[model samples]
Target: MSDTKDSDSDSGTGRCAGCMESTSEKFRGFLNFLWNPEEKTVLGRGGKSWGRILIFYLFYYAFLAALFAVSITIVLGTLDPNEPRFQTRLQAPGLSIQPKLDASIKRTSDVIFTAGQADTYTQYTNTLTEFLKPYKENQATLNNCTNGKVKINQQYSMEKPPPSCRFDLADLGPCRNEPYGYDVGRPCIFVKVNRIIKWYPVGFTDLSKAVGNADSNAPPLKDVLMARNRAYDPNRMYVSCYDVTSGNQTYLNTAAGVSANTMYYPEDNGIPFKYFPYYGAFLQKDYMTPLVAVQFNKVTRNVDVRVRCKAYALNIQDNERMRIGYFTFTLRVNE
Candidate 1:
């Protein structure tokens, strides 16, 4: 009896052990990652690492894209500042530049009067008087120093300059017709005439000097800028362009549409230009050089700029006074 009871107890213990082993095996399947030595300690393939890699690639691609964008923007800016297309030519009247500049080469000596030369004195004096001899007594009104009649913006170029006096009188009247050749009217009529003649409301006084010059000996076709002057006021500033080169006067045919004797030349590279060639009459608004078939798109880029034109004096040059020369000035767009 004792032996049989012992055997039964042993069998019960074995069954209990088997049940515990089966339960451990099932739990091991659920927690299998806990004992994997290589996976637990290795340094890679985590979610954080993948996020960082993705972010690095995004920034790297963005930087390259920005660099390329800047490079393209710089290269694409080579378009002409002055559009030279024929259809768009008549858009801006001020931009309507002709082939060559036109203005009479006048000398200051032609207007100055000498005491001994009565004929010459009378001729200029008559011209002076004719300019001043207005039919009306309102001469002082036009002088800005006095009554200041016309507004500043109202001024424009006409075929003829504004009248010095009313009713185009032929003569200043001999007055004393005196041997001294002194001017008539009140005190300093000649001085006022001289002032008006020198005060050009339409022409440029100075020329520009540019930067990054391609050549040091050539005057390139550039957008002419206003040079410098002491008496120039920003609000009431006037402009004018003078011939820098002392070349012979060129007479262009506006009718036939070509220029001769002028220094401006077109590029032979057959590069299609965007600007039209324009020319005006010597002293008038006449189309001496009509909107020509030339171009100015590649003017500044191709041409080398070296020379900045100096202010040409149009009066006598004795005793350091430079006033006896012809400076036909016309203002072109600076900007």
Candidate 2:
């Protein structure tokens, strides 16, 4: 019985050794296939087959890259780098104001704050201070255009850039003071006409001839300036602001008496004609948009008043809905 058990154990050991040898041989063959196969084939693919696939992909990607390059070149060829291709909507420029409202405030266009509180109006004064920094720094070097001569139909180039007029900060008068009159219940708001490339303001020589009659709803330019008692200047682009909350009566004769409370720096309330026909930024690198500072003195306390400011010129349109050449904002002074 012991001899029979020994023979069976020997047979089992030999069968296990044979299975281990077969597995080792199969693993060696798989490694050889991955590194280098027989019959000049690499992983079952001949050299010519690999070469054909590589060449096909190279040509396909090369053609795709060439097509992309040509498409971009053609598109860019049709555009002017310095000027806009289409300016149909920008025929007339718009208006903007300084001392913009705080970003946290929900009402963007309205200026509302308590008169005596520093925290309430400090942001407004800071904005104006930063805005005038460049003008204050560069005023000495800028070209003098105080002769009131317009630069029109002139050629400009990169080598010979167009000259920009100097807008002296000193001309702002009392509004140029550090406090800007905000601490005393009065506020100064600066109005700027947006810059349009190669656009100039054309003033009316005669209001009766331009509008075809003096009885139009649009008040004559002279009447609009009558409140301020400014003499009419046909060569200048005039800016006028008045209370819109007054009923039926024209802006000059508003019930709230806006003209009585308003005063303009450089008293004329007009932008000189020389500032117009602004060439592009590249040609007129130092160009500064002229500003009209409107100071509101002794506004009725704690009342929400709507004001509309308009820039009058023969070329500039006055469409309230479109906000072309005009801007409206609310003013509320708290006690």
Candidate 3:
């Protein structure tokens, strides 16, 4: 009985050892098949099959990369670096003003400041100072085009660049002063016509008659032309600013009374014809946009006065919402 039990135990131990060895051998075979299989295969794929797949994918990706590069090159080749491909919005250039309020202040074209406080008005003066810096520097080097005649450059070239007219900073007169009138109640707002490539303004031959027939929103031509020591020119693009606090009625709010006391730098209240037909920044590197500084001499203190400035020309359109040739801003001078 003892011998029989011992033999049975020995037989059972031998069977268990054989089972473990079979499992180990199977695991080794699976690992070998994953790395390098028999019949010269790797991961169940023959060497030729693996090479074929790699070559196929390499050529496919290479073709896709080449196609993408060619598409980009073709698109870029057709575009001109100097000129914009589309200029739909530039048909009638808009108008912009400087000494604008800081972006942090959420105001819609409002210049609000205390006359006596430096912090309130310093930002305004600083803005004007920086904006006029380039004009001051490049004044001497620019071409002095004839005042009444338009400067036209039909053809542009690398050798002979387009002509750029000199916009002398001194011409800004009182507005060019260090304080810029912000210290006092008076404030000088610089108005500039938006630059449109190769677009020149065609001035009204007959100023009085043109104003009479112009859009209802047009600035009063009679009041604009009657500026003190006025320098009126029929061939130049004119700018006029008037208080519109009470509906469409245009007048300057003054201590004396409602009158046209607003003043423009250059005495003419107009931009000379010589500065028109801007040849873009690329062709005319040092080109300066002509400015008309509108000075509000006495704009009733502590009141939000609505003011609208318009640029008059035959080609320019009067669209307040679109800001084609006019811009409206609020001015408030605090004590």
| TM-score per candidate, chains pooled | 0.20, 0.77, 0.79
Task: Please give the ranking of all candidate structures by TM-score, highest first, separated by commas.
Answer: 3, 2, 1
Per-candidate RMSD, Å: 27.6, 7.9, 7.2
Clashing pairs in 2: none
Looking at model 1, report the run of 10 residues with the lowest lDDT sum: 267-276
Could you say which candidate leads in lDDT? 3
Per-model tally of clashing residue pairs: 18, 0, 0
> Which 10 consecutive residues of model 2 have the lowest summed lDDT?
209-218
lDDT string for model 2 (40-69, tens) is: 777766889889999999999999999999
lDDT of each residue in 93-180, candidate 1, tens digit only: 2211111212332433212322244543454444444433342244334322222122233332444433232211112222212321
lDDT of 3 by residue, 1-335 (tens): 99999999999999999999999999999987887745777788888999999999999999999999999999999997668899987788888898766667543457889987999888888877888899889979998877667766466776788788888777888999768888887889999999988788886766564452233355456556754545457678888776667554432456332245677888787888888777777888888999999888777778788787888888887765566878878888999
Scored by Cα lDDT, where does model 3 land? Answer: 0.78
User: Candidate 2, residue 39: CA error in Å?
Assistant: 12
